[model samples]
Target: MHIMEGFLPSPWWQVWFLVSLPFIIIGLYQINKLVQEKREALPLLAVAGAFVFVLSSLKLPSFNGSCSHPTGTGLGAVLFGPCIAAVLGLIVLVFQAVFLAHGGITTLGANVFSMGIAGPAVAYLIYKVGTRAGANTYATVFVAAALADLATYVVTSVQLALAFPGTAGFLGAFSAFAAIFAVTQVPLAIIEGAVIMLVFKYIVQLKPEILTRLNLLSESTIKKLQEAAA
Candidate 1:
């Protein structure tokens, strides 16, 4: 969910900007390193950024000053780690804020923090844990993507609740925002998860070498996925 442009009042927006700055800085560094180390990944990185832009632009009216949509950060996180994904997300958000009017420049920091930093971080962690646990590759992808979408909304809710606690206080406000987001976000998460799973499968089938270079999958697992696709 994107908290609309300028919806957040004075200090809250500034706070979020400060909080999100470090991640963005680190993400930029990571991206430069990636570009230098693996020029072959440039095209795939573009695809990931486009995926985030397109999916997140599909906004549906939700709570006041906010909207719900699929956050496509998980695929990038799974493909290139969370820091690099954050850079991709930041670029997408900037474009959305400028031309698309989906989000606002004032609240860009908050949106990036939730969708880019928090969501991708959680997704990357989940993917790592799932793979380490010997879970099915596609299944893990689904879970990571789904949970990443949900995580974005959750962080958005937190940001909203913090900005406007009202009489119900922070916890109460968070519960209210989260409840509203869950109605739309849950379904979107499931659909995004399925879509990302399919995309990952395709990548596994067609570009297993890339996965091997990235250490995303073991040779044995890539072989199995390739065979399954065949």
Candidate 2:
């Protein structure tokens, strides 16, 4: 869900920009280094960025003034890590804000924080934990993607609540916003998870080497995928 242009107050949006600035800078640095070192990742990054751009652009009406849509950063988070996901997300958000005019420059920081940073960060952590626990590849991807989507909504709700606390206080407003979005967001996240899970499954089948290069698909995981393919 995007806050749209000029929806947020001046101080709040600037604060969010300040908060997200460090992460964006660091992500840019990491992405530059990665591209310079391994040119092979460039194509995958483009695909991932495109996924986020197209998927997130397809918004469904809900969440009061805002809208709900899939924040398609899960695959990138798992494959490229959260830092790079944030960078890709920045590109997507900025493009939408500038060209499509879906969201605004003032709220770019807030949107980036929720969809780009929070969601991908949680997804990456879940991927790490799930894989280390020996979970099935698709299952882990599913959970990671689902949780990442949920995390984005959760952060968005908090940002809204803080910005515009209604008759309900902060916590109450948060709950209210979450409940309102839960109707669509939860299901959307699940569908997104399943869809991305299938895509990742194919990555495992076709270009599993990419995962190995990212250090996400370990030798054992590759073996398991190969055996299953066999």
Candidate 3:
């Protein structure tokens, strides 16, 4: 649900833009810190960003004019952490805004804050919490991805409701969009989660070395991997 440039009233949009500027700046600073700390993952981040761009570009048929696309933030956050995912998302959204016109320039700040920042952040939190609770990797990935996708829609709905208060109150708008979007998003989330889990499983099998370098697959998991490989 990308908000067009002039969707909101001029005065309100201007105020929202001004309020969102600090978040953009903070996001950029966090991105810079991530780059400095995780230089090795830069190439991976680029690759992941490219993947997200391509994946999001492919629109699946959905309700009315609204279409759904895969949000690759969950996989990225799980693998590289949310800081990098947030930066990757920002880059992807910016490119899409300029080239594809999927989202708008004036609404870029709100878009980035909602889809890029909130999605990955919530996904990472869910994944972490699930893992801590002794959930299986696949389950954690699935739940986190689903929640992340839902969270983005919720955030987008809120933005839209704020922009067009005549439609409904914030909660009402949020619930309406969530219900509409969930039809497409829920299935997509399941598909994405399965794909991510399978891909992770294969990568661990083919190049366990990469997992070790990333400090992802634990020693116990490595043992299980070797057993499975055998």
Worst-scoring 10-residue span by lDDT in model 2: 59-68
The residue-by-residue lDDT of candidate 3 on 205-226, one tens digit each, is: 6787877776766767766766
The TM-score values for the models, in the order shown, are: 0.90, 0.89, 0.81
Model 3 / residue 192 / CA error / Å: 2.6
lDDT of 2 by residue, 1-230 (tens): 77898888867999989888898899989888988998876887888798778877776444444456677887777778788888898899999888788788889999989988999999999988988888887888899999899998899899989998888889999999889877767877887788788878788888887778768878787888878878
lDDT tens readout by residue for model 1, 24-127: 89988887787898886688789879977887777634444345567888878888888888889889999888878878999999998998899999999999
Q: Give the number of the best model, judged by TM-score.
A: 1
The CA lDDT of each predicted structure is: 0.86, 0.84, 0.72
TM-score-better candidate, 1 vs 2: 1
What is the TM-score of candidate 2?
0.89
Give the poorly placed runs of model 3, Cα more than 4 Å off: 11-39, 59-67, 225-230
